[model samples]
Target chain A: MDLAPYLLLAGLEGLVQASVLMLTALGLSLVFGVMRVVNVAHGEFYMLGALIAWACGAYIPGPPVLGFVAGLLVAPLAVGALAWAADRAVLQKIGYNPEGTIVSTIGMLYILQQGALLTFGPDARAVDAPFYYTIRTPWFGYSSYKLFTVAVAILLVAGLWLLMRKSKVGLLMRATQFDRETALNFGIPVGKVYSAVFAIGAMMAAVAGVLVVPNQQAHYLMGTDPLLLSFVVVIVGGLGSIPGTIAAAVLIGLSDGLLSVFFSPTLAKIVSTLLVALVLIFRPEGLFTVKGRRA
Target chain B: MTKLQVEGLSAFYGQSQALRGLTLELSGGEVLCLLGRNGAGKTTALKAIMGTVPPSSGRLVLDGRELTGLPPQEIPRAGIGYVPQGRRLFTELTVWENLEIGLMTRKTGREALEHALELFPVLRERMQQRSGTLSGGEQTMLAMARAMCLNPSVIMLDEPTEGLMPSAIAGIREAVIRLRSEGVAILLVEQRVDAVLPVADRVAFMDHGEIKAELPIAEVRANPDLLHHYVGIAARPARPATC
Candidate 1:
């Protein structure tokens, strides 16, 4: 069997995986980096987004494109609202204590998972692509929607980078992250910023869900793999470093995709797990982060 | 006009009380220094006014507006700027970024930035540098400048001259004087009586979380035993009698 075409296909698939992983991991990184809250329920937010997209796709009375677009628009807003409420009612009430948030988010994870299971039922569902088109490569044809996914992910990440670097809200978030007391002394409402950041983080995960639902089935438990992979990405990227998260996501995503294609999926998982362990032991601060940078 | 008035303010940290009926007042354009030994509750009194420590009892009013029980973030919005004891600049951020954060409450723009730079020209030269890398004196200037960015009517400075060289202390003294002349009321807490005596309009001696004595600058200057009694420092040569 000629492996060259297969390799090319694998590399493209890797790009797709890397793109989605970057979006998901960036959300996780931002939440942890700024709020110092380990949102164990992050993966469930991804799952909720996919389920919301599936529902929107099914119920919206429109063409497939319009339905998919509605799903895309609705899922993130819904997830963001849910996350914001959770932050205010639960996390803030708990004082955002590190250990407490971890436990609370775990409870949230189970609640979200079980809620989806009861409402959406046990079946996996898929949404139709907004546009039906294909691109002819040198050796084969490829789904143009997948390419669109990659492009959209890139654009969203770029937008996020700009927001963090330039906007007033971004400035407030950074200041709060650096020193909550000092930020408060400066009259920046730390609690409100925390809720906003939590919401934004969940919205990013939901976006990844919306983008990927057309290609993958939306199941109640589908968030597990992405959650695991995102943790790997964040850990290897450095906990709070945005650039580090992106770089780590690409590295892990490409390796996972290529390894799964060339070898077995099980072997790919094992290798990625091993990579995380090695990184944790050898360079705990992550590959891209400088020493003493806030984790 | 009285810019700030504290009456019978008391605060407790957990089980132990840190402040006991601390009472003081500051007029617009006046500098009131709180001088005391460590654990004398001078810092606690400042924290209570800033709302960082919740006062158990008493009323705090600024410009005739009640300030008790307001959240710490809201206190700054009520025309009080705090330069905390440690000069807590956001170390990771650039000098400009630190100033930008400081500008949140006042909404002052480029002009405020320029003003801060003019006050500490070294900041202009180090705009892009990370604040953690600045020298101790430069950090002190940045802290004061950051607080001043709020355009606050009343500024509270806690231990601003701690660990600073004579030149840095002199720089701070000059800044405080300028702010006073511009009609900005100041509540300064200092252990160094010599550094504050020249600029303070009145001095309140605190011991055991209560004011032991309140005297005018001239009175404290003439009575060396008062300084020795409250602040525990031998009376030093007073600033030239120009002012």
Candidate 2:
């Protein structure tokens, strides 16, 4: 067993996993931060993105980049539009009913999953890599495509950080999260912001699907595991905190990566699940929290 | 010109009505005090006028523009500023962020913010501080100052003095007076009748979602019976000692 190759593989894979986890967490965290609803349908949104990517690949012609980009862009936007409509038509009717929101989201998840299976059959489809060329590297014997995936993830996180901190829209988003009524008083157009955030969050989830499609392939049911894993990451990170999400993602990725490397991957999954349960029991607020912020 | 006019404004929270046929008019440069007991619909009137709550069927005109059913954000753009009850500051946002957010909805740039901070200079010092941790009085000032940042024609405050010390309330009164002198129409919903009587030209007493009485401040002051009758607070008549 060559140690160097395994380390390279694990690091590259872990980085990719972290990126997807971060993107998936974005919507879940945003919805929770503002509306206080744990949207169980978030996974369905991811599934929608994957299905879109698969459909794009099936119909479209050209290199993987076009299909991947099409899937990345279109899937999330469609899901976001769906999320927006759901919010206005269904969620708004209940008017912040926690139990109602939860049940509705779960219902949405089932509807979407069944809808995906109906539209695109249950069989998994291979998704070509967006970039197939391999780079000649001495130590890290990985393709350039995988390296690009890692780079893209880093750049996106950086972009998200800058947008959140430096932009006026970000300021309004943070303000609205704190108090929607007060944000409206400031003329922030609270309704529009809610829509934009849901859209953007859905977009992030789709982008994650696009990135992972090359490795994992696309299927009607590929998003379920990511959804569960991201929830664990989000919970460990402390709900709605960006730094918390990334930190928790990295922790989860590294832990699972190392454990799977040492023992069986199935054992690693069991341990991570146990760890999450332990954390929930011991530190209910989360491993890292600056006062939970009420939802 | 009259900045805010409410004709037969009524609001409902589900089946129970909050504001029942409330009518009032406010001209520029006037500070109209809304004095009432708790749950007297003072806040409801302000929320209605600012378009926070939809009036079941009533007329709201602000500077000649009909504003009956506009949303809360639209009302501010229509030149109405509101400081809600409980100082409803975004507890997670910083003081500067809260103030800057007021002008964000407006097409105006940093100039509006500079003007707001210039008026309430204290916020300039505590710009980075989170609003939730601010003292009750400081939060009150922040809320009022944030509303003023919008530079709206009419400024409506819902209980700006609630849960504050005497000095803070006095500071707010002074600010209202200053705002009045500047020709900004002010509607202050307050339980402290004495605190506002000096600056108020007219006072409206409300009970059970209706304005039971409206009179000049002098009339309200001279006849503390009006206060006792509607608001349940008696203005102590200082009796001369018999020599």
Candidate 3:
């Protein structure tokens, strides 16, 4: 058996999955890098986006593209507003206890998940991929929609890199990550930076949700898998290294894609779990570390 | 003209009051050294002025503008640059990045960057090195350089010469002297009396929270007893005013 077509398909799926994970993980990395807050409820923000898409489809008559785009744009703003409220209400009050934050966000996650289930029911919901038909590639004999996903992922990553690395706000972000008090001394409004970062992080999660639903589909429970996988990606990448997170996401995707082809999909899951554990065990500081903590 | 003034500034750590009714006045082109031993609340005084530790009841006037309960970042924008203790130069960031963070307030041109690098020629060579890897002298230099980037009218340094070699301390002393020559009002808080007082124009000693004594640098040099009493130093305050 040539097995080339199947591998290509698997690679396409893996790339798309990696793309979604990388975007969300980038947000997590930035937040953790600066604020040291491990937001466990971040997955809920993605779920909220999916819910927003579904609601848009149900209530308003529009193309699936419009609905998905609505979710991408609207959900983050909504979640960001929620996050701002949450930051001022909770995170600010507690004064940044890592364990406490983890507990609070996990609690938030449960609330969002259950709330969605109660509103939408426990059953999974299907999202019509904005691009409905597969683009026939005579040479590869695989759907080019997968290729489209790859292109979008590349663009998203590029945009994020430029924003974090080149722009003035990007310098502030890095400065914030580098040293909070120094940045403050340099006349940086830290509270504003926090809110902006949290919103952007929330937005990335929402975009991840939109990307996933088109191909993999979304449900109240949909965020659960990505949330778990992103956690794995973050741990493997290091707690706060953007480049490390991207590399780890791709590694995970490739592993899943290849393992799925050779072994059962169940085995693929087992291998991915093992990979996560192995990374944590070996590189306890994650792939990148500056002075024991994530930089 | 007074560049910065703190009136009846009392600060606290939780419930314990660190500073009580502390008032300080510094004019532009002046070097005012706050001299004290540990626990004298010199650090707290700097913190209060910079708005890091909110004064429980007081007002800080920077350039005739009140900085009451203002945030730390805003205080700097009001024309005060602070170099906190331990040279808090984001250990992971490179020297250039540390410099970049300092210039975040202003739109710094290449000239300013070149000026900063020239001011501390060592920083030019060490720009790529992470701050943590820098020697204590380099860190102190970078900290001063970072503060310099804000183009501040007034700068406050908290024990910047702590745990440094004589040469490093001398380098900082020269920098402070140069800063004053450039007309940047400076508040140099130091535990080491002789190390800083030589270059200072005026000196204020703090025993508990409030200023115990305020005298010109020449007056301070005359009273070695004052230095011994407050700072617990046995050294005769040097009479180096002839230089």
Candidate 4:
């Protein structure tokens, strides 16, 4: 058995896992950082995206590429709209109280999960990737679609970075995150900004879902793992810190992939959980967070 | 002409009232100072005008435009700038970003920023630094500069010189005088009467949420006993007037 080849495979697999985890965890961190709401239903939005992609792939009368394209376009927008409606109709009405939003999102999680079960049925489904090609490496062959997923994730993350750093909307969101009352007094419509942030966060998760659905089975309960992993990532990374979330996602994702391949998936889970515990004990603020002014 | 008018304004915090039928007016290019003890509703009056505190009964008009009951976000758009207490600078943001937020409701470009920087040159020097790292005086200057970026017809400042060295206080006083000269109405709420009085065109003494006396600075200067009775301190010899 060539251990080098196995390690290389694990590394590639870890990259894929890290890519998906980055999108999901970034969304979670953004929502928590700005709205200060623990969106218990964030996973449901991911599940919804996957299910939506499945439906688009199955029903859209076209080639696999067309269906995949439709799913890519429609899933995120639909989920984003749904999240915005939730913010306006439920979260905003509750004044976005931290404890209240937690409860409300828990209720949303159940509702979304059950809604999928009732409408989409309990069976798991998969969507075909738009293109099927392999890139043969020295050790083995890898799916081109998987590499595409990595590329798309990198592009989207870069775009998000620019949006946060350069755009006026990003400035308003940062201002609102720092001090809601002061932002309001400055004539920034903070309520609208909250809705936009909530929508964008859900959209990021949905895009991740759309990207990963071709490889994984889209089930009503598929959001469970992503949600749990994202929570671990954000906690280990530090809440509300973007760069920290990305760094932590890569660390956790690579470890999970490498460990699961070398040992067992259950062991990987235990290790990650223990790692989180250690991080909380030692550096509760996360690994990559800056020491300056508290956000 | 008066740029802002507060008629019969009242505000309450849950069960207790903070402002009781407070009425005041600020003219264009004139600086009006409100002097009062702590808990005397001086801050509440400013908050009510800014729409941070919901007015129970009042009418706020800015240049003949009705402003009462408008949302806090809309108040800035209606041509009023506010520098709230504690210099609420977005601590994590850079000084430039903080100033950008001040232009949230206004349509101004780099020229507006340049004007603000001219007023507080230290902010220009520390444009890239996080606002939290600024000294107390610099933070106050940044807060004032941020408000000025709105290009507002009227600006309300609450304790702009609180906890500052004499030099920083002088800077704020100079800025106030300059803004007045630029034809911007100024509504100032301050406890530092000695530092603010020289810049004020008129002073209104507030006690128990009501204005006990309103008079020009010259009239208030003439009656030292009135200053002693209302402010608990005799009016100091008037400083050589400027602005």
Best DockQ goes to which candidate? Answer: 4
Candidate 4 per-residue C-alpha lDDT over B1-243 given as tens digits, one digit per residue, 9 for 90 to 100: 989999999999999999989998999999999988889889999888887888899899999999888888999988899999998999989998999887657876777788889989988789899999899999999999899889989999999989999888888889998899999999999887687668999999999888988999888778878777877887777665452
- Ten residues in sequence with the least summed lDDT for candidate 1 chain B: B234-243
lDDT by residue for model 4 (A1-295), tens: 5999899888888889999999999899999988898998998889999999999999999889988899889999999999999999999999999899999999999999999999999999978999999999887999999989999999999988898889999989888888888898899998999999999999999999999999998999999899999999999989988999999999998998899889988998998899899989999998888765333
Instruction: Please give the distance, in angstroms, between residue B79's alpha carbon in candidate 1 and its true position after superposition.
Output: 0.7
Q: How would you encode candidate 3's per-residue C-alpha lDDT over B19-95 as one tens digit per residue?
A: 98998889988999998889998998988887777788987887888778888888877778889999888777789
Candidates' C-alpha lDDT: 0.90, 0.80, 0.79, 0.90
Docking class of 3: medium
Task: Give per-residue lDDT, candidate 4, residue B68.
Answer: 82
Clash-forming residue pairs, model 3: none
Ranking by lDDT: 1, 4, 2, 3
| C-alpha lDDT (0 to 100) for residue A15 of candidate 3 | 79
- Hey, what RMSD does candidate 3 come out at? 3.1
TM-score of chain A of each: 0.97, 0.91, 0.91, 0.98
Best by TM-score: 4
Q: What ordering of candidates by TM-score runs from best to worst?
A: 4, 1, 2, 3
User: Once model 3 is optimally superposed onto the true structure by TM-score, how far is the C-alpha of residue B236 displaced, in angstroms?
Assistant: 5.8
User: Which runs in model 3 stand beyond 4 Å of their true positions?
Assistant: A2-9, A56-63, A118-121, A132-141, A288-295, B94-96, B106-118, B121-135, B236-243
True-vs-predicted CA distance for residue B176, candidate 4, Å: 0.5
On the 0 to 100 scale, the lDDT of residue A250 in model 3 is: 91
Cα DockQ of the candidate 3 complex? 0.63
Q: Residue by residue across A33-73, what tens digits does model 2's lDDT show?
A: 76677888888788787778878877889877888788867
Please provide, for model 2 over B1-243, each residue's C-alpha lDDT reduced to its tens digit, 9 standing for 90 to 100.
Answer: 788898999999999999999999999999888888889899888877766677887898989998777777888888888889898898877897787787666666777677666666777889999888899988988988888878888999887887889778777777887788888999988887666666788999999999988998778778988888888988754222110
TM-score of chain B of each: 0.96, 0.93, 0.94, 0.96
